[model samples]
Target: MALEIPRDRSPDSSLWLLRDGYQFIEKRARRYGTDIFDTRLLLQRTVCMTGAEAARAFYEHEALQRTGAGPARVQRTLFGQGGVQGLDGAEHRQRKQMFMSLMTPEAIQRLADFSAEQWQARAASWAAAERVVLLDEAEELLCRAVCAWSGIPLPEHEVATRTRDLVLMFESAASVGVKHWQGRLARRRGEAWVADLVRRTRTGELSQGPGQALATIAGHREPDGRLLDERVAAVELLSVLRPTVAVSRFIVFVALALQSSAGSRAKLEAGDLDPEWFVHEVRRFYPFFPFVVARAGEDFEWGGYRIPSGERVLLDLYGTNHDARWWPQPGRFQPERFRDWTGDPFTLIPQGGGDHYAGHRCAGEWVTIALMKTALAFLTTSIRYDVPAQDLRVSLSRIPAAPSSGFVMSNVHRA
Candidate 1:
């Protein structure tokens, strides 16, 4: 029994979307007391859904497709032109396996180790400086770590430029004006850099270690026995590098979360709380990306609402994590709740949800957790810094947000 969904009455709600940002879907859902609704965005009819159940339905293979799913602005900036996000059916499954192959236990452990080593090395310089901007430093440091882990050789001088470019892609994915253009420019430049690397690896000008991400992706074959185009291969590689650097944003929030809750911070410092749980809670509580977009595949009904074919749909990743239906006391910063988490995919989707290899869930989910936990291990156990007066407030209206102060700290020293 499909029913007509609640529709947003505001004419041209695109501006409202800009104003509300992350709460664009959840606030409306609360007002209508529904988990799903229909609206118009960018002059296109759009359907938005929230909550864990909505996630499950949204991710169902036959119900939606990734092709033409994301906005053109997002496509030009964040995901690039042709990457795994746009593929569907057999192509999607094949490309996804290439990413999942790099996420084995040994590989994930190596990423964690790299993060710890890089953080400690970077911290030495922090001690000598009067103030440290953790976000900036973390981006540079993560670029170094991920490059080494993925077997991509990066010249030391190019680190800052590459980090800035990657950050621009994620930071401006939702922007409208100059910053959005900046993201587009950065992506083009970044693709050229990696496309050359791919070309070199293919021609034996440079060597990649056995089973490395670069080697595998460069040599991978599609179901039809064809190689991905050089630029598309570059896009896939950025899928790894960009997200790893984006972890710096979550790293900043970890510091902010710990500061806001002294009990949790004290427990962390005392080695009483698990750093992994703290990392998970930070991902769950903070706003990363507001939503993920897909297109409705073959008309379907969910929660008694009709979802028509070819309509742009959004899954509220932020709202699902914060929904009181799954998270009790959703506004509270509680790391303990994660200790008993049952590993349900849709429940806490700071990253995307559903099957990793089989569905659209982020391929680097393990890599992200590994990176953040390593940072937590270093922050809580190894180093100490004083949080001086600064604007630590985060504006929810910003997609891919960080603390306004970039989580500034000073008086740094080894713990």
Candidate 2:
């Protein structure tokens, strides 16, 4: 039977459902099979197969490609025409290779040392405050860590203001109207700042710190090939900066999870839980990048539905992560689900699968997981939440719905 796609919109369109977006997609996909729905501006499609199978197929399908126009248009408006995130194929790959060198195991270990020290220093200040907004504190820690690792001179006050503006730009990019306009303006300013930072680092004139990641990348060459062009290099650097900016949210979400879940909290506090298991559970349970954008590379068939070439597809990361077939008690948080289950890596992807998958499956996974583990270890054991516990509210349908406020922490004690 052919999957029947509904052309008519639902009263409460699944488009607006962010927090539980995956659940909604799953229900609809199961009912309609792999059908395509119209979203006025974009095409929405769903895949109902289990994680491993669906992810593999989704990755292999020739029809799946990035909508470069959207990213390109936005990047041009915000950062000019040269960053790696806006490029595709050979260009994007070349830029990524340059970045990969800066993110090596030894390099990351060095960065981690810097990050840990900054976290400790920042936490000292928070310990003295009678009442502290944890979100602000976490952002400051992340900003300082980025500067410390990248050799950017981000003053504390400037870091606070810029981080807020950059976050708003990302938020605005997701929707239309005034927010979108504001996001564009913010992005433009951010791009100029990023370009200047790259230029200064490349010239060996950037003040503060010796041999940071950005400086290394700026100076590095392929050996077999030529060094990356400054424009492409700057864009790649911005790519690094953009994601690291969100580290605060990742840190806050993991902290909130431990603080709210008594069982999970006890395990962490007692050191009974494996760090890998806890991290996986946090990735699974926490809402991050729920939807990723892709366009059909060529015409293809899936689940009895014929998807025409060049059609847009939004892979619901949140839905796939929580698929009941792949995940038992799909809605529940369980890291042990991955402990003994011998399965394909593609199925367990919180990041997208395959080397070719863009944006979501880049080289940042190891660094991100390591960072989360370190932050959580420090947070769960060292600090205590002062307020009565409350539900971490998220629109299940939204992508990347973390706690609106950074999970507030106050009563300071080393465990």
- Note each model's CA RMSD in angstroms: 1.0, 3.8
List model 2 lDDT by residue over 1-415, tens digit each: 5665454355445454533354655556565544334342333343233345656666666566653534443554333455544455655566566666666787677666666777777767766776666566666666667666787788757977777655655555444567667877777677677777777776768754445667766765643577656665665565666666666677777777776677877876777778778887787777676555666667777756666666666555666777677788977877667678664656566667666334326567666777787787777765554754544575655434666555555565445
Candidate 1 per-residue lDDT, tens place, 1-415, comes to: 7888999998678999988988999999999999998899999999999999999988875879998888889989999988999989888999999999999999999988988899999888888899999999889999999899888998988988999999999988989899999999999999999999889999999898977888888888878888788999999999999999999999999889878999998998888898888888999999998998999878988877889999989999999999998999999999999888998999999889999999989888888888888888788778999999999988988887888989888998999
After superposing candidate 1, which stretches have Cα over 4 Å from the reference?
Answer: none
For model 1, which pairs clash? none
- Among all windows of ten consecutive residues in candidate 2, which has the lowest summed lDDT? 40-49
C-alpha lDDT score of every prediction, in listed order:
0.90, 0.62
